[model samples]
Target: MIITTSTAGRCPTCGAATVSVDDAEPWCAGCEWNLDAYDRQRRAPEFGWAWVDRWSHRLGYRLTRRQFTHLAGRPLGTGGRSAAAMVTAGVSVLLIGAVLALAVTGVWLIVAFPFPNVAVLLGVALLGLAVALRPRFGRLDPELEVLSADRAPELFALVDEVAAAIGTPRPQVIGVNGDLNAYATAVGLRRRRVLCLGLPWWGALSPPERVALLGHELGHFGNGDPRRMVLTQPAFTMLGSAADLVRPVDTVAGGGIIEMIGEALGKAFQWMLSRLLFGVHLVLVAVALRDSQRAEYLADEMSARVAGIDAATSLLDTALGHESVALAVRREMRAGHGPGRWRSAVAESRAAAGGRLSLLRQLSVREESSLFSSHPPSGLRRRMLAERPRHDPLVVLTEERAARIDAELAKEYEQIRRAVAWSG
Candidate 1:
């Protein structure tokens, strides 16, 4: 079965009817030929470390497997806030208290010394570091082409509709960038919702699929992850910064005995702090993994309800094909022809991927469904969608509306295309 240009065609392999959507090559429903065409490589994402990554892969598989099994049997619901959320809130409080304690200790040290001394100098350093490590209130990036409701009424309207459908408030801030991803987060002290759309992926999707993307992200508002919680989010950032500050610097040998001893002490202090931060980070992230993955499933289900199962499935498949998009951008950019041809180049790359896509997806499932991963494997996600009750798309994207939306985004897309192409 072979289908191209969103048209049905006969599958050469099994003579099965192949249906194509949104100009992508069709997969035969009968023989499942070209099913892997969305996946271009048989390689899974990695940490690029040999032994550590090997161990991580195993651990991630085990954790995801167990969690998936549980999710499969049980109903999918985030339910009320759990005790883990309370624990994370407690951690956030302790982190803030630690900063206050540091400030107090610094002041006490300076006052008790009452003269020029190492104690005074140490106090000053502590004060500076404590201030430096203060939790930063997140702000939307100024460099992004932020689109206000007036600037992109059509886009904002779509977001509003999706938000309403999903029972979440529309994001307070919306911006576009060149990455092959998108995210919705509650940012800042006020926890104002912010949504950022990555142009590469946006350009690749069909209209209903875009709805699915929005549904999946905005759905996070109702099914919150502890990491995204206002209190814990800042704590996570503060801990990461603290870890970076305490990370040891390499020392050259052949220094004086005193210097050597001082360096050793410094290294020991760094090692202790680093390990403490690592342990805390591990616990926080590990505890959140199950919930996070479950949230992904819930979000996907929401997406299907609003965007239809087929559209959501297509979106997931395209997500798995981002490597194809990335590769195409790189290939065309290097040849000095990618500035405006990125979308076409991506189409070519996907076509070239052909049979390898399925294998790539299979390999990626392990990586994508890992304990450390933010989401479950696309394969499992699609399977879950298929097993669930089907729903008609609530918001239909007519060709005319899609065209209008594209027209509105034309300027931004032009600039974004060049940026993504050249940056590749």
Candidate 2:
């Protein structure tokens, strides 16, 4: 489906060996020839702000080189998500200081309970501080329809199998929503791992491909993505808060020169704070980007290992196929079909595509390359997968078993279909 290290082709530019990933195109690892040809935006000759763009482009260019040089070729086996010391230390100071302050406030409020005025004010302050600095134990999104084992035993069993194969803990909650994607996350104070499947996507995938999806998603927790870590994730959230707090503010001046000067000074101070925040953000992000990309590669490997190379690559093809597949979803929304015929709809759309799918996929690949994209370009990912050794699927979903899952989610899909139809 993706990345292969076969040297059957030759690179015209360097006379170096060319590798074909997914058989779409042959590219050279030495020069990264056609792989970057898709990044049209990066190759643009002009920009609205030329000077700023030139500098930014240089930075991006450096980052892209750093990415492939550090990340390419071999399997990235659970490259753990890493955080910058600056971010880690800085977030720790803020949260720990806030916690300590809250503790002190609590003790003060308790001791001063004998005094009416002070106690009342301190008590109010305690509640406010506690709320403000509270641990961000993320909450489950209410939009999801929670599915217990009793409701969807076959589906839950599949999850258990995938988790076991990936060597990760089974998600405590499995839910579904009417969306085009799936995700794995930890939610609530106890940090219950949750898998929220998007019905449209779930319905599109083959049984083995679904296992690949599970492998990649569940791999997030095992790969040590700092964003998924309950302890460090809150700290990352606090950084966003700090950035917003220091964000630049526009100042309006009254008629007087003195007032104008005062406004200018205020604006300057705000700008300085904003710039400092930007610097912190830039540094922290640069540090985190490497780890994040590494984690993605590792997750893909887990997917390949758990569900076989072909299935994993086909699953990744969903990235390429999403736009084409959206037509099916839209058609379903328009038709208001109960129980949502995803497999048939998806097949119909792909069949209509004829020869255009590859071109569309290439265009999509070009459009997705960015300095800050969370995942590596799907094309590059495919190539990486091709280069790595292939693996046989560890978990397989038989047709009859898949049918059982479809039956279990039938009512939910029907309701979702009606809702989508009405909303449209």
Candidate 3:
């Protein structure tokens, strides 16, 4: 259960210490923050779209997980297994393209020309096959601002400390961005390890929580998840690329009777190809998500070992409570006034919301593990940590060092925010 402070007593908008509670709705004497009124707006009572969207995602995720578990036994694989899966997927797409080419050639000969026009039929067939088989390699750019050791020695030093504590190699590269998330990913065909830290998310955490979060991301590298994902990512992209090459609705119609007949045939062929590709895409995603969920569990355990269970649990709480309080913080930040501290702002928003986190945690427990999600539910992670033996904190943060680190990165955070917005 989420232990919450008393609500109907404080103002969310203006950071007012107290509000008058009249008829169950608290009104801020300091500002226009009315708890009941803001809650209604935040929840979006109109049309119930939020609940619908959430339920739809949950349903799809549950089905995907079920299908994946039935097809592939638990603990999907190491990097090699993922690579083999991608190779098989690539070959399957190529084979489908070749079959489609032959089918197209036969149809063109029967419908367009009275006799066999060998050269033209071959040209059409080859062109269609080439189009279907073409690969769209993902973009190489990291996009976010890359931070080198020279530029941020203190941050790198902290990362090194965390890595040493966890017995993992330090990330080769570091990038900073605006997201409320931090992750370790392998980039490019070379599989370069990149540690991406989101300043917004880091700024929201306490010093101990920061250690837990950073250790968790670094753990992904040692856990073998990043390498596996890098290998399989291109294959998932290929499925979408193949589907796009023969999308049924993208076909154009011409005026002549023969042209119309050809268009209809093309549409039918495309429709069949799309359905086949979509089914393959679904299966591939399910397998990928299964691996992702396991990777997260392993990574979380590493964090628990490196940063202590209390810190890990606090990190999880911050992550779960983030979405609930994000809007209120955004509104406050947008008005030129400032809460100045993300953690305090979140706490105030939670108080205003009246322990809605208890409800969110309950929902998370009730919802089945999703194949569409990269991480397991927060409640599940918390429970797993609770069952594990406690360890001493690996890297304790002195107040002086923590404050100095924050001081150094303060300007960099602003720069990152501007860059993200400008890039968009």
Q: Judging by lDDT against the true structure, name the best candidate.
A: 1
lDDT of 1 by residue, 60-87 (tens): 7667666666667445764565555566
Q: Report the number of the highest-TM-score candidate.
A: 1
What is the descending lDDT order? 1, 2, 3
Tell me which of candidates 2 and 3 scores higher on lDDT: 2
| Better-scoring candidate (lDDT), 1 or 2 | 1
- List, residue by residue over 1-424, the lDDT tens digit for candidate 3: 2333336456657766543321222445344343213233223232247675455455644553443343232332233434434454555566555656666665665566654577666656666665555443333345667887777788889999999998988888887777777878766656677888777677667788888988899988877552344445544555766676668775454589988888889889988998788668666665556556666766887888778999998788777766655554454344432324665676676566564554454344334344456677776667667677777988987657767777667777666545544553
Candidate 2 lDDT score at position 407: 92
TM values, all candidates: 0.76, 0.76, 0.68
How far in Å is the alpha carbon of 93 misplaced in model 1?
Answer: 3.0
lDDT of 3: 0.63
- Clash totals in order: 6, 6, 0
Q: Between candidates 1 and 3, which one is better according to lDDT? A: 1
lDDT of 2 by residue, 1-424 (tens): 3445556677778888766544545556666566544332434533347665455545554565466567677446634333443365456567657766876787678677775677767776775656565657688999989999999999998888888998988888889998989998887767789899998788777777888899999898788665576555545555445556656676554588888887788777877887776566555555555556667778898999998999888777765778667677767656865333666777676677665544444433444554455676676677678787765789988878888898999987777677777876
lDDT of 2: 0.70
